[model samples]
Target: LEIQKKGNEWAVVLDSKYNRRIDANTKMEVSGAAKKEVLKDKKFAYGTFANCANGQTPWGTYISCEENFDDYFGSSDENLKFDENFKRYGFKTKSEYGWEKFDERFDLAKNLDEANRFGWIVEINPFDAKSTPIKKTALGRFKHENAEFIVEKDGLVIVYMGDDEIDEFIYKFVSKHKYVKGGDTSKILDEGTLYVGQFNGNVGDFRGSGKWIALEYGKNGLDESKGFKSQADILINTRLAA
Candidate 1:
């Protein structure tokens, strides 16, 4: 339904009305690009290659995550090959789908920088295919399997996500704003904080409910020196930032 690229910035295939592409020059406009002009770079999706693993959002939008990216491009080492990170999901180092052969951008080695943009949760509004899809980096950049939503009693937002690879972490993003019930989906989603979880408990903790900790920005023991410059920065490099 929707497609996207992840990196320090985010990009989406604008609905058919505003659809755009990111060549060697364009940057993406994912969530959290308020400052530093990180969203200026726009390399939109080429017609050739497309990513997968999509689900529908409550707001009539589609969420898609890119998996098994190494196969798209030529990787010099096996480390870059589909590592354990990709295994948790349903991907192998060798891609059965030969999209790369059709598009040069599909090749990871040729577009090494692009590789950083994959493995993210992309948001698409099928109703408006003209609008560009966006990569919500606040969700972290990994082999994402799902982005399911569960609203709390107070109308706060909570998105549950799985890494899909072995030993990968499950994460959630609790919104700072309450759900409008019928508000503009696109506008509301742009504002929220991303968080990762670490299930902790002794023998009992493992079996019972796992505590949910908010991966605060520069709080709860995050480095201040090389810390996230803005919410955009946090969303941009969520994987590395965590």
Candidate 2:
């Protein structure tokens, strides 16, 4: 979808050539931290279309979020084992969308890894029609509400995001590299430090200082001892790490 301004008015037009409507069946590539060893060659997965909120980058790209994605997958009564991360991310025994009725990928009982593929912040380049959207797993996955970025004076980007569910945490991603004008900002999200907020002080007093806890693997007991194999594992199960 593109918004174009004519001589006197602005109009929203569907540029089918450049505009893409990703559905449940669409396939995408997984990148960032999730591309590590355990998920190396398994970087491809089905689409993510339950976009609730979106954000844009300074380089003019779209960030599509997947919210309430768990409702699209169905469960089974065969006592199938579910990924512990699934329970933390709120996978139900029954699907609201019932997408599993048609596609077996939506059935967690059948494809356990399918559910892990969604709930990510996907980046789409509206300018390039041939470009495939990237699933930025380094930003951490959850019920992503929105992803807003603030570029500092030195060109370092700080991305602020939130988990929409009640009592959920707020997150921020700081790019490891500084942004350069006229340079490629597409891969900036691929490598970054993800942090979760922890508020202190009384509830009614808006005068509390908060801390941004780093979610990096091997830091603060986020290593294999805690069942986190790599940075990708921590990001995929961000809710549990938070």
Q: What is the C-alpha lDDT of each candidate?
A: 0.57, 0.84
**Candidate 2 residue-pair clash tally:** 0
**lDDT score, candidate 1:** 0.57
lDDT tens string, model 2, 1-242?
A: 77789999988776557766676666677788776532444757767777889999888889998989999988664466566788887887688887877788788887777777888898888887777777889898899999998999999999999999999999999999889989977678988899999988765666667799999999988988889988888988999899
Question: Candidate 1 versus the native: TM-score?
Answer: 0.65
- What are the models' TM-scores? 0.65, 0.91
CA deviation > 4 Å runs, candidate 2: 7-9, 13-17, 36-43, 203-205
Number of backbone collisions per candidate, in order?
32, 0
> For model 1, what is the error of residue 151's alpha carbon versus the real structure, in angstroms, after optimal superposition?
2.4
Point to the candidate with the largest lDDT.
2
